[model samples]
Target: MPQTSQGSQAGEGADPAPAGRPPEHPPRWSWWLVGIVIPLVGIAVTVLTVPSQSPNRPPAPPASSSPATTRPPASPPPLPVGLFRLTNADSLMCLSPPPGNSTPAAGLVQGDCDARPEQFWRLRREETGTGVVYSVRNQHTGLCLSVDAAHKENDVTVTQYLCGDENGLFPDQFWSFRYDTLRHAWRLVSRNSGKCVALPAGSGDGEQALQEDCDGGTWTLWRT
Candidate 1:
């Protein structure tokens, strides 16, 4: 017997089936193709469109007029760089270490801070009266701290030397001030380990006072 053609077959006149066989349906590829393509497109779009959230950090604060809680201030200045009048126990001049590089050391002592060029002072930094500094200049020598080497604890000395070499400046010559006399007086201070700072002598500069009970005398009466 002749077979009948099915409408959904490949060819217009394609045969659907033989007498006892079921009609062949075209493989259902449209649904499968759509399912694969839709998921693939969706994944591609997600990859291209999403963004990251990772770049914004925080800030810092202004500086304070103080040392850290556990530590002390750094060091003394080169020498008295500002307007100062020396009072070496009624002696009118600011004292300096006696002559050295000669014989047995005279150790660090006070000489008259007079019109001698070696006694005149200028600041280490040009910024006037800044930090813990007061540049000591020699009036007669027209020179500043000329330490041949860096100064150390206790053995520090001031000299009437030229201020050219980097190591010429000693740390002991410069005076540091902490507010005193109800903030009306200024006292010279020193640091032991570059941390804690305190006055070295009593009001008379005898190396006894701890900046707390300085003698109310002219020797320690330093003005800005």
Candidate 2:
């Protein structure tokens, strides 16, 4: 009978264990407090650690002031001054007035290549366009090649006249050059009459220069 009572006592202890599993106490207040306080502390820390802008700070410099901004260098001017000889392509002669004749009416003539001061011409740029106008000045007499009375007539003669003469400025003094690709030569065209400098038919030494319509003929071809 005592063994049966001890077995009943053990069964009763086992039943209390199942009742104990329901809950020993309600949820801890410390855990609830920790959950609420931890989030509040995190929000407070985030607010305190964030950076703020100051209204008194100066503005940054412009992008153009940066090292990447640079300007290109300027280009050089073209040189149009030089010494040359105006040679007739057909006659194979140089244009030179008689060295002693420095008068306004002294006509220019085709002469043998002597490389004299009378044949040495200084070309100076007068204007720029599709073609550039140059004043052909003689190194010997300091005269300029000009048309007779600035005439626009065909077969007119070319002469060496005083540069900037009191007779007044004339376009006849300005000569332009056109390149002849076919002949590989240049045509000396007068600015006033628009005529090409030419050697007369059967030209010889001391023959005067003539103005004719440009036809790319060997007589109209000139070289510097």
Off by over 4 Å in 2: 1-80, 128-131, 165-168
Q: What is the per-residue lDDT of model 2 for residues 1-224, given as tens digits with 9 covering 90 to 100?
A: 43667667777745455544565675789789999999999999998999876679678876785477566644333323677788888988999887667777698998898858788888878754646678888888888888888899888998988777586447788887787766666888898888988888668999989888988579998777
- In TM-score terms, candidate 2 sits at 0.60
- Which candidate gets the maximum TM-score versus the true structure? 2
Clashes of each: 30, 0
Candidate 1 positional error at 55, Å = 80
Model 1 agreement with the true structure over 8-119: per-residue lDDT tens digits: 4556766556688767786799879988999999999998898866677656577787976875544434334464443333333344334332222222234535454333
Worst 10 residues of 1 by lDDT: 190-199
